[model samples]
Target chain A: MSKEKKKPILPMIIFGIVSLGSYFVLFNQEGLVTETYTKGGWYAAFPILTAFWFSFVHGSFGSNLLDVVGLQAKKNK
Target chain B: MRKVAAVLIVILMILPMATAVFAGGPPPKNLKKGIFLEVNEAAGTALFQDSTTQETSTLMIGYSVKAEDLKLNKKMMVSFEEHDGQVFIKTAEVMFLDLTLTKFISLIVVGLVGGLLSGFIGSGGAFVLTPAMMSLGVPGAIAVASNMCHKFPKALVGSIKRYKYGQVDIKLGLVMAVSAIAGVQIGIKIQKVVLDAWGNAGSNLYVSVVFVVVLVIVGGYVLRDAFKLSKNPAAADTQSKLSLRLQKINLPPMMHFKTAGVTMSAWITLPIGLATGMLAATIAVGGFIGVPGMIYVCGASAIVASATELVVAFVMGTYGSIQWAVSGLVDIRMTLLILSASLIGVQLGAIGTTYVKDYTIKLVMAATMLVVAVSRGAKIPVYLQDLDWATLSPTTTAVLNGISFWALIAALATAGIIITGAMIKGMREAKQEVQVEESHSKA
Candidate 1:
């Protein structure tokens, strides 16, 4: 039980850093990002792809962060 | 292999239809996103630099636009009307608001609560988040677009989590989504007819009336079913009588949905999906009808219904976001900000489901629907007054508006409290059970 309870601290830290880095890059390049993203053709894929990318990276970071903090679903019978 | 191919073929067929139909409805007409460089109130014109092309164009402001409303260097979305081959700005407003500390915090807070509710109920956030953003001074079109942009990712995360828990029925979700796309087209046509015939006020009245009627009827039924299930635990997982009767019909093209554990004819399932889509186009929250329809009409359990609704949300939201994005309506900054907190909230809510019974989901959903009904109900009189069908004093209008807004907040707050409380109780019970098992092993 003790071994099973080990927290996922390392993965959480790595994902947290990567997620924050991605956010910083996007925010810093807002002008170029907004311009390229809204061009109304193939450029439409930009927002959808970006959303998926963030959901994967940031979403993993969030899930790991919760597990590290000891929030998890109870094992079903 | 055959089943997989069939599903893929269906999705491929529906994709183009969805794009063509839903494309023309939302984000208003001839709208352009740009930054306001100069507002020359004296000349009734403004110099706007297009965000996409960086081209500066002087636009003639319509009579209703106040010079004070135009802020320099702020992102703006302007709607244009072509009169005598000259384009004039019919409406112009700031697209993205300044992200001050207070507004930032408020958005994150609402995102978290809205995310939690969505995770629990399968469809939420848009009903409240769009209004919340509009109240913060974001243009209505941008708010809807940004909200849609955030929705798909959030739904994607929640659906994947629930899928892992064996709650989602992918086949059912896809079938429903395909039919829903068609329904949205019809719903949009109805909306356009109303808007053209009676204008914005009539449109608002139509939406409010539909909102109240649907919420009251469906929410009351769900609440009653939830109460009955709570009273008799043995009947908690039983299919509704309506669903059982529908399933008995030997209609052609019967589909088996394994996760939902239901086998029903295509004829029955498709109508529910279509209605869900129609309601979604009208109210911007299709899950209100979709989840209930799945449970009571399609013989799905509440858990499966809610989880499947997430799948439908993912499909529709992704499609809608792309439409809005191409039109340059989505404010990515706002979308990402909401996603930042909602991702966390959604994961937590998804986990919360493991600890509670199926009735709990129905209860939360019903409670939310009823409260939201009150919120929209409060706006009906205001809309009627706008159409000159009813007269309302300024103070009365103000009070009704306040009730409408606060009722939305109340709905969010109530769901949050119920989810959190139930999760804590569930976790405690599980911990105690684990402790008891440990003691038994020692003995």
Candidate 2:
């Protein structure tokens, strides 16, 4: 009897929605983003914070996305 | 106990260095970020509101700034010159651009490939990404800022993955980064002097010349080493004779890098880190020198050097990003757009390392360095013409520019193919071994 491995479908879907949603919101508010993000001073934190936020959200999505596609590191012997 | 104390001392030493140069090099002179409220073309001036202070000021237009280029009520980044106490707008650039499909795809593709290269070799992709963004009509400064904004997060991800594999040496990375930061300051000062002396063309010429010379020498040496190791796969990975000899020197403050499996004097290690930082500031690709320096001089294996490089990249990238962001130069749209794909690509590349041998990493790094050297070399003639040192026809200039761009694409494609091929091959062999063992047990 052979057993098939399960795909990370659930996590992929969850992160995919969050990632896409983030992009949608950012692009929709492009004018406000440009103004606030480039303000400099204490406001300079805007771009740095946004980058960290995406790295967590979209970065996780990408990881799950790769697993769903079956691209993963080989098991160590 | 001694090791912990040494590490603490190192951290303490680095803190003051960080605080001293945290502002990073020198700020660009006469540059301002603001929103244009109104433009009076007839009067050759515009009502500009500073983004930070929200203060209103009339900026006199310079002769080079065409009246039609001024768009009312748009965010603009401008450079100014004080002529007899009158502020003249020397150059103006739109801070944000409309996100079109072509640009989005281009950025994602480049980011993915660049992330892959970075994950595999520790540092790369930025050397090409900055120029690629500029080609897509982003200003050089903005392209650099956005590239830096994307770099740290990607490097952070890569470093975390490599750390899980037990390949990262945090101490070595930190020690190097501390001095690298100081090196970046000095490098920037040198760049400013060159820019002030020679203008944009001169700067480009200087950068390209350095790129070609360094890449050729270092890439050639690495490629030769990779070939030697490829021919002798059974041989143990060892420190070079240079590193072995240097390790014998009884200099004070001898440091031990646990993961890299080498102990050397701080005197030896600090210079390598400093050179890495200086080159990073100069050409925006410090990894080319940093990795090779670790492998050849510091006596770390390519794997350790590359993995540790992710740490260096993380530290320097974070520091550099903050400096650029504080200047309000980072285009977050471009940064996020690149991150969307690079985050994925970096993870894949990091995993690829688990499947391949050390020489494979060196092979990819060498190939990339040589190809990128060619790409930069193609731009030398254009810079020469800009400096009035040489003349070239417009057609020739266009062809060279095309070659320069395509050569970068070629470098990325070549690296991607080699990495994928090696990973797949290694995985297949591992699977075969697993099957053989299972069959034997069943029999």
Candidate 3:
């Protein structure tokens, strides 16, 4: 119970904020993002690279959120 | 030896079909990637700038495509046919879809469940997501492209999670993935031949039929095995006799996968990978065939087979996404929206596996595959009607479409229920055991 109480809220919040920020930026600039992304050449990298960014940032936030909620894998030992 | 011979015979069989396609088939339809430069409403013609060559050509827009709907300067994918020295556009789809509130929520919901399914069973979502997005009014190519763009990263996250639990075999996954790419080429070739002969409706019918047949046979076998394994938990970790026999074969270039604990001839794995790729190209669900082939043919246990398949999915998804993105077909907005939920779902699913037995994974997969088969089966009549082979009233067509779409929803719902139920039950049992051990040690 004490260990549960000690779980960090700070990093989770930080990650959550950044994840939300990234999504906001993309949506807010939807027109530019779409135009640049669909340029059909070197611009193709924009979407692929952006996907990688969200996966890492948002993925980390998800990990922390799950941990805070007490869901975890069983230890073999 | 006979099993190996049978696999060889199957490949040989596919060769003739490939040759037959090449020898005498209707001209393949031209699916070009380009942007609309100018739309002349009066002539029902549009000037298109080809994405690849930067060449501008005039295309006659079919009556089905409204001129008002054409968006100039937007990247588009056009399906056309060359007739008597002129290009005729059958369909022109703007690659990027408008992200509406309804579409946004739907992508997240589907992404989360699909991710969970993929994480738990090793293969899922593609069969359901593409159709689900299409139902939400996204064009078929955009839906497929965006779903694929989201898949590789989800697979990467899921595979990494499973790998931490000592479930993945990179060597095995890489071997299968490389061979599978070759299979994709052949599958694409076959699809082109079908498209040339019967056009869009025919192509859809071909895909649906293959989807139904493959899912029924493979899913049925896995379900029966799941039942057997559940009845006798002690045998859950045992390898099939086929794997044992194949391991004994003295073929050269034997590759031993440490995590899967299998050592077999390299020759044996290639055919399975190729078959998986072919299935993937034809149906857009390679993982469906890949995981099962790994288990039944390569002799890997279900747990290892499913986990290794994540590696294959990651590789194939990345490769496929690049191909789509290069043509500017990927709707990044949709891809990100889905990933927003799926990344989380995938990780949760990966952890859930640690609580349950291998049979649980097989059971979830079997359930998903069987229900998904029903979903595709319901669409067969609709496609038949489109081909004019069968006449149906408008109401019947609407009813069939409803059945097809709802059946997909049902498959997702069923799989979600079973996976969550199994995970909860398993997690509760694990916690109780941990508490008991802690108390005993303290006392």
Top lDDT model: 1
By TM-score, how accurate is candidate 2?
0.93
- Say which prediction, candidate 1 or candidate 2, comes out ahead on DockQ: 1
Q: What is the DockQ of each candidate?
A: 0.69, 0.63, 0.55
| Candidate with best TM-score | 1
Q: How accurate is candidate 2 locally (lDDT)?
A: 0.86
Q: Which ten residues in a row have the lowest lDDT in candidate 1 chain B?
A: B19-28
List clash counts for every candidate, in order: 0, 0, 0
Q: Quantify all predictions' global Cα lDDT against the true fold.
A: 0.87, 0.86, 0.82
User: How does chain B score by TM in each prediction?
Assistant: 0.95, 0.94, 0.87
lDDT of 2 by residue, B124-233 (tens): 88988988998888877788889888999999988888888888988899888888887887888888899899997898899889889999999999999899989987
Residue B125, candidate 1: alpha-carbon lDDT = 78
lDDT of 1 by residue, B61-148 (tens): 7555667767788667777777678777777787656688888888899999999989888988789998899899888888888889
Error of 2 at B56 (Å): 2.5
CAPRI-style quality class for the chain A–B interface of candidate 1: medium
Q: What ranking emerges by DockQ with the best candidate at the front?
A: 1, 2, 3
| Superposition error at B1 for model 3 (Å) | 32
Tell me what TM-score chain B of candidate 3 gets against the true chain B: 0.87
Write candidate 3's Cα lDDT for B174-255 as tens digits: 7787778778778878988998899989999999999999999999999999999999999887787877888898798887
TM-score winner, 1 or 3: 1
